[model samples]
Structure formats: C-alpha cells, structure tokens
Target chain A: MQVTLKILRFDPEKDKKAHFKSYEIEADPLDRILDALNTVKWYKDGTLTFRRSCAHGVCGSDAMRINGRNRLACKELVGDIGKKITIEPMLGFRILKDLVVDMEPFFEKYRSIKPYLINYEDPPATERFQSAEDREIFDETTKCILCGACSGSCPPFWSNSEFIGPAAIVNAHRFIFDSRDQGSDERIAVLSQSEGVFRCRTVYNCTDACPREIPVTKAIEQIKRVMLYNR
Target chain B: MYRGQSGMWLWVFHRLTGVGILAFLFLHVADTYLVGLGPEYYNELVFLYKLWVFRLAEWLLVGAVLYHAINGIRVVLMDFWESGVERHTQLVFGTLGLFLLLWLPAGIFMLKDVKWFA
Candidate 1:
C-alpha cells in the first residue's frame, strides 16, 4: 500500500525552524514504521534522518511520536496506524533533526535519580539472596528500557523541565523497592523534594505513551506513597 | 495539545473544572456578603439567581463540582494506595460514571423550574 509519512524535519545548521515534509512510499501493510522510514531515507530522500539501532523494540532508540502518540518506530506497524502517519520528534525534548531528539536532558534526569543499585555493604562472596516474593515487588519497573517515551509524554515534565519525570521515577522505583537494595533513604530524600514525585499530577500520559507497557504513572504513584511516608 | 488520548482529556477537564469552581467561589462569597448589607439587598440578589441563565449555570456548576470532587478523590486514592495505580483507568471511568449518575438526576430536578430550553 502507498503510505505518506509526514515527517517533522529540522536542520539546525541550515533551516531556521522545524517543518513537516511528507514522503510517499510504497510499503507492505505489515511493515513496521521504522521500515517505512528506512525506505524514505534510502530510496526517497537521503536527508531523512531517524535513530534505529536494533530495528526492533528492545533498543528503544527509535522512540518518537507517531500519529500523535509516543511509540517505538520498530514496534508500531503501518497497518495499525492507517495509511497516512504523522511522525515527529518526542515531545518535551529539543529536536536535533528529523525524528531525532536531544536525549541528554532525559539522561541527565535519569542520572539524577541514581538509577544504579546502591549497596555499601562488603560484596558478598555469592550474589545477595532475595526471596521470590521480594523480587516480585519490583518486577514491573525493571521492564523499562529508558526510552524517554514516558518522560516525554508527561505533561508535568513538559511544563517544568526540572520535574523529575516518570521514567526517572520508574527507574527509582526499580531500586527503591528492591529488597536487597539499601539506598531507599537517600533516594527518598531526592524524590521528596518539590521537583520530585510530588510534582506528578497523575495525568497518566506517561503510562499511555510507554512502549513497553510499563505502568509509568503507577510507578510514580508508588514513589509518591513512599515519599509521603518518608517525608 | 492534541485531544486524542484519555489522559490528556482528563487533565483538561480537571483543570477546566478547577478554574471554573474557583471563579464560582469568588462570585458566591461576594453574593453571600450582600446579607450584611440588609435583607432587602440580600433578597434582591437571591431573586436574581432565579433567572433562567443563573439557574442553568447552577446545574453546570453542580456538574463541574461533582466531576472535580470525584476526580480529586481518585487522584488522592491513586497517590496513597498502592493498588490504585494498577486500576487507574478503571478509576477514571468509575469516577465519571459516579459523577453522571449523581449529576443527571440532580440536574433533572433542578431544571424543573427554569424551563429555559423547554
């Protein structure tokens, strides 16, 4: 079928502002949005740019707004979104080029949350043993791929860039809820601040936009409960 | 922003209702202060509320209050209860249902005297 992918294009070195450019390409109905984009870059316009590492959903590099929703380009099939699809860079981020956004701000927030597990005790000869029930406590948050989809979809994050986003809260939940981890107090101090989990208004956009189907808002809420008690 | 998703619409409604309620509160307080001016002035203000536009606005205000209050409870539940997170969408629709269930009947009874549209 013939699909017209209307792409938001920006060339900081050349163009003064971003604008939409449509590329009509023949694609199989079942092809992923990434495939259609590849066709655009290869056979249509060489300047058409987007990020794709694995060409699959796992990498999370090709996350962008497709048809007014945040999704992974590799995961969303053309058949699902109909013939004409509007493609743009993710919201709440600076666009570097076509379908490419500057993810530095997102990563900075992730780093601020201390996503890595923190344990100061001497290293155990064997891995720390955690009960099956304890491991299950944080299983949902571990599914996050740090794609920035959840963070970008958040309205609070959009309004105040300083607001620690849903993705950061999700990542924080991963470590905060872990039974074997010991950084809960430190993490709680960071999250309890005005710019932290309290800023989330439960808008649920983060949950809706997550490609991995992670309950981003739920994770944020859980963090809020923890912060409320710890405060 | 595009009005395509349930989350965005809920946020929009919540903000709209909150602002509307705030505006109504100021007007309500201002009118209540008319009681100090004397019964004559207060009765005159109350009589003005019997107008069709004011009556119709009262029904709409009731709906706004119902939605905002119910949705506020949902937000509070989601924040405090761990299980509330898992059932967020259900709670949103549930609150809307409760709002309509209350507002529809109350509106019918309240609109009897106004008969503006009728």
Candidate 2:
C-alpha cells in the first residue's frame, strides 16, 4: 500500500514557520507508523527528524500527534490509520524541531512531584514488603512511560504551560497511594496548588490519550478525593 | 482540530454553554435592573425580548442551559464515582440524550407562539 505521511516540519536554521511536508512510501498494512517514519527518514529525506527508541512502544520516545491524536507511532498500525496520515508534534510543548518538542518543562513538573518513594524509616532486613492488595491500588499508574501524550492532549495544559499536567499527577499517584511510601502529604501539598490537580477540568483527554492505557483522569480524581477526605 | 472523541466534544459544549449562560446572566441582571429606572424602560426592554430574534435566542439559551446542567451532573458523577470514569463515554451520550429529551419539547413550546417567515 502507498501511504502518504503528512508531517509537520520545522527547521530553525531555514524556515521562518512550521509547515507540512508529505512523503509517499510503499508499506505493508501491518507496518507500524514508526516503520513508515523510518522509511521516510532513511530513504525519502535524511533531514526528517523524530525521536524513537525501542520502537516497540516501551521507551515512549516516539509519541506525537498522529492524525490529530496523541499516540505512540510505534503502536499505531498503518492499517488502522488509513492511507494518508497527518503527523504533528504533540501540542502544549515547544517544537524544537520536526516531530520533537522540548520536554524539559514536562520533566520539571515530574520532578516537582517527587516521583520517587519517600520513606525515612530504617531499612528493612531485606526489602520493603507490600501485600498484593496495596500494590493493586497504584498498579495502573505504574505503567506510565512518561510519553507526554496525556499531558499534551490536555486542554488546560495547552492553555497554561505551568499546569502540572496529567503525567505528573499520574506519577504522583503512583507514590501517593503506595502503602510503603510516606510522601502523600508533601505531594498533596504540591498538587493542591493553583497549577496542580485543580487545573484539570475533567476533560478526560488525558485518559483517552494515554498510550499506556492508564486511567489518568480517574487517578487525578482519586487524588482529589484523597485530598478532600484525608484532610 | 484535535479529532478527540465524545469526551472532548462534551468538554467543548460544556464550556461554550457555560459562557453562553454567563452572558445571558449578565444581560438578565442588567434588564432586571431596568425596573428601578421606571416602568417605561423595563417595558421597552421586555418588548424587545418579545421580538422573533430574541425569542429564537431564548430557545437556544434554554437548550444551552439544559445541556450545561445535564453535563455538569455528568462531571460530578465522574468525579465521585469510579465506575463513572469507566463509563464516561456512555455518560456523555446519556447527558446528550437527556438534554434532547428535555430541550426538544421546551424549545418547541417556546417557539410555538413566535411568528417566523410571516
């Protein structure tokens, strides 16, 4: 099948504004969008740039707006997307180049939530033990790959860059609900601020756009409930 | 345009209807305040509202308010119930269905007395 990949391209050194560049390539229906992108960069145009690692969707590096939705290129099959695909970098981020956005701000928000577990108690004899039920509470959030798909799809994050996005909240939820972790107080304080979980308008875009299938909006809502009742 | 699904459309509609309702509230407050200015000013404003254009706008306002109120309930449901998140798409469709159920009859009745294209 001949697929036309309409990619939003920008070259800081030359182009004054971003523009779409189309490339027609022969591909199998079962071929992943990442494969098509690889064909374009390797054969059609060497200047075509995108980020991809472990092109099996594990690394979460190749997330972009595919056909006006945030999706990992590696996971979306060309068969599902039809012949013509309009690809653009994720929204709510600075476009550093073609198909790449500056993720520094995103990571800073992730850092602000203190994503890692915080336990000041003495170390266990071997390791911290947790029952299966306790693990299940945050099991869904642990699948987050930080692909930025959910956060980028969010309208509030698009309108206000400072809004600590769904990704950060999901990361926070991971630690906040853990039975072994003891940082919920501090994390809740950070998330209860103006730019925090309240900024979410229950749009559910984050839940829809998650490549990992994380229930993002639900997690944020759960955080809201925790803050409300626990306080 | 982000080709988002039912959830996105609901959010967009909710926001637009909310803004529309707020604008109507401002207009309503100003019009109600006209009573203090005397019966003449208030009656004049009321007469203007009886015009066909304003009557049609009133129908739209009714629909907007209905949809916004119904969808607001959906948001509240989703916020409080875990199952609401799982069934949000259904809830959105249900909200729209309920809005249509209530708004259709109200709109028809509101516009029945208006003379259009006469």
What tens digits encode model 2's per-residue C-alpha lDDT throughout A1-231?
999999999998998989999999999999999999999999999999899999998999999999999999999999999999999999999999999999999999999999998999998999899999999999999999999999999999999989999999999999999999999899999999999998888887888899899989899999988887778
Tens-digit lDDT track of model 2 for B5-28: 788888999999999999999999
Clashes per candidate, residues 3 or more apart or on different chains = 0, 0
CAPRI quality of model 2: medium
Candidate 2: segments with Cα more than 4 A from true spot? B36-38
Residue A219 local lDDT, model 1: 78
Best by TM-score: 2
Q: How high is the lDDT of residue A156 in model 1?
A: 81
True contacts kept of each: 0.62, 0.59
Tens-place lDDT digits, model 1, residues B42-107? 899898788888998999999999999998898888888878977877987899899999999998
lDDT per residue as tens, model 1, A1-231 = 999999999998899999999988999989999999999999999998899999878978999889888889999999998999999888889888878889998898888888887899998999999999999989999999888988888788888988988888899999999988899888888888889889898878788888888878877887887777666
Give the Å shift of residue A162 in candidate 1: 1.1
